[model samples]
Target: MANTKAKAPPIIDFAPFYGTDPTARQDLVAQVRAACLDKGFFQIINHSVPATLQDAMFTLAHEFFALPIEEKLKVDANLNDYHRGYETFRSQAFSGSLRPDFKESIDFGPDYQPDHRYVQAKHAACGPNLYPASVTNPAAFRTTVDTYLAAALGLANDVLRVLALGLGLQEGYFEGFATDPVATVKMLYYPSQEPVAGEGGDDGERGINAHTDFGFVTLLMQDDVGGLQVFDNDTDSWLDVTPIKHAYVVNLGDCTQRMTNDRYRSGLHQVINRSGRTRYSIACFHAGDPEYVVRCLPRGIGGEGGEEKYPPVSVNDYLTERTKDSYIRAEALNAT
Candidate 1:
């Protein structure tokens, strides 16, 4: 006997969205809407970010992570007022899962000046990022990362415009929410898995616990070594999101789900790096303006005359609560 299940998510091409043909754009919109309603996950191709930039960022990540532990600790994430610096392995645990995730990561958010309003106010998610002095080429690393972040943000804004059109709103419907958005980029490294002693198997250590993104949307770029999985609600099983060259795995987040009154879901995903080689990935998370009040859209609120399914809430408050629960020792919340 053999088992059968879906292994990959739908892959969508963005060419149609950029063409002059109205029909093509409409078709693209339809596809996006279906993907959102079905799995809340999809792979996008033809996004404008350059391959050279992606490669450079990945190289920089490898260099930074390969540094000695002591050297890498100069700018520890724990010491930062805002959660922006290097996080050691096994420092984060999913809310319900007591086991710490088996990976290390570095987090960065919108670059703010020391005297900027948000930074001055000690906003939980806004401040200058910490860069490690131990890196061989600190200048190159910072330049590459900043360039990548800018490109990712541009892509996110475009995607949101398409989504707004898909939902029957003006293309700029989401523009207001994106102004000075809470955009964060995280570089993650998962080392090869090791066999556990006195156990029948590898003990199933997870690179990251199964959970949904807490923002409006997330764009992920993974290396060829695949270990990411998305939970399939309809089949009650996990499906691998295999890496595609030059493609980004896009998925909506809690804010988008709530804003759509559950019309669009926030898929639950986890990472398990079983590949003999180490795995690295960069995730760009975009949420609406922190102070914006999120409520169900008119089109999604009462489809076909039903009542609104969600209550309005502030984005900052919602993200703050979720982040506190996601990390075991979240001193960053004190700033809020």
Candidate 2:
């Protein structure tokens, strides 16, 4: 059972890091390290991304999702080899439950052409993005999204630098992994649902089921409708992550845990939207360069035997295996 007095995720102000004060920078790094090792989650405020841009991205999401069902289907993600387009509502089941997640999404990545190195080599989840040309202003939609993606990538870069420092490495330690990154920006829509009785009397159908992410890190921007919850290992309960205006909810992924040999956690979280209003969120899943090998960092291999918890694996191989498992699980549930 979830605790009635649930703890909220720690909120950190990130703007101070931009100043030239070394103490401020170190303090920010310490906060991030603590969050990663504890809850594996934190909320960031006063970041570089503009508020206007975020609002514009949400507006574009509304515009795209408002299209007719047939119009949206023209870019069905399943039709393409890269799954870079639209994914239908309730088509994904993240927790191995019979009930699929009640959400629809459209994914966009770096618009690589056929001649790009990754695309030419047929890398997993690497391809050009698909935009809905049928929208009222298709050009505006694409342009705004592209701009927003750039902003998200910028924020990710800064966060990665902070993470590197927290891990006791040079700020540029993660740069090698970023060369030709396979990151993605996903726009998700979850419709309102009837409440169900469970862990907290508020637990309901899964908007997104309980699962850990499959990459280096995840950065999410969500609207006012509350549903996101993070599992608290200490209290053995689910805690609500209330939205902070224009703030990003950042979390580590499985790959990060693998790199740290489990010293840092990859927390499990789920969404349950019973607010009687639709929920919209944008998540940037930042995977590293496909070919980079993820090995345990020196600082993390410190058990009695100094052994690594997980063997080294390439980014592509890890993501491919995880992605395959997700699809298979979703398909199995849908078939039931």
Candidate 3:
């Protein structure tokens, strides 16, 4: 019988990127650039986030999901206008599919003071978080999540440096853009889906509908129970992105695709928990400053007077529009 194992995503280590050796860093940058160009997704290891911290995060997620429905609803995200707090199962869709995802999530961002500049400006993505006091050890949950968010943001900044080098720009080229990034960390819980419908199933019950992320980049940490799949444009088939010990799945998003003038495509991916056990994952979405104007870089536009394929757009507008479309679709489906 032919080998039936799914193809794994390319794996890259961050050690070289963090070291003082320029040659090693350059080589790593080249590898990353190639991977982005070809697949727009890769697994990163030696990323500096402690394994203990990762474990703690998974534990908190499991505990959160185990809370009573009433308790969980106390921090329902629907109560907030900025998309923070807990989202119940089957609350939203990924994109085209009107079917609700079979997962619950809690979204949080940088803890901005009420008078902070971003908050003062009324940036929807920058604000306080909603933590349920009903959960046992709410303090522990808060600390773990905050620490994880810090770590994720650090790693994201480092990756952006690598991408800058790969694109032949100054290492700090993206720093200004990220100064006040509209970042968000989401904790996702996917319940067991035993006896799942047969292969090629789309009965509006997927764990997460197929779609591309709308941010600049996303760093995802997943547990051992794997069901993540990436759509390969070349093969027109789904490739399983198996979980690797101590590795984070990194992928470009729609904004990055546009900034790169389609040189690096945003990966289309989804999750389906076929495992009998529940699945937990954390995703940190790092975007440019809300007011930053994004346009195709000269190199991204190709050589010899290549035309710009995308127009300049502020990060805030782009994200707002995307969010509107996503919620509109979900609301339409729910109303039916």
Which candidate ranks first by TM-score, i.e. highest? 2
lDDT of 3 by residue, 1-336 (tens): 554444457898889977899888888998888878877899999987899998888888888888899888888888867788998876777567857688899998888877888778877577788977887888888888889888888899888888777777788988998777899999999998756477866565668888888878899999999989998876678888989877999999888888888887688998888799888999999987988888888863322136778899888889888877777777777778
How far out, in Å, is residue 239 in model 3? Answer: 0.6
Q: What is the lDDT of candidate 2?
A: 0.86
RMSD of each: 3.8, 2.6, 2.9
Task: Give the per-residue Cα lDDT of candidate 3 at 315.
Answer: 87
Q: Which residue pairs collide, candidate 2?
A: none
lDDT of 2 by residue, 1-336 (tens): 754554577999898779888998899999998898887899999999999999988888888888898998998998778779999976767655657788999999989888998888777789888989998888988998888888898888889899888877789988898766998999999898887667656433688988999998899998999789999988788899998879999999999989888877888899888899999999999998988899988753323136778999988889888877777778887787
Q: Which stretches of candidate 2 lie over 4 Å from their true place?
A: 1-6, 197-204, 299-305
Model 2 scores a TM of: 0.94
Better of 1 and 2 by TM-score: 2
Provide the lDDT at 87 for model 3: 87
True lDDT of residue 151, candidate 3: 88
lDDT of 1 by residue, 68-176 (tens): 9888788788787678889987676665554678899998778887898877766557888887778888887777788888999988998898888877888998999
Off by over 4 Å in 1: 1-7, 195-204, 299-305, 329-336
Deviation of model 1 at 126, angstroms: 0.7
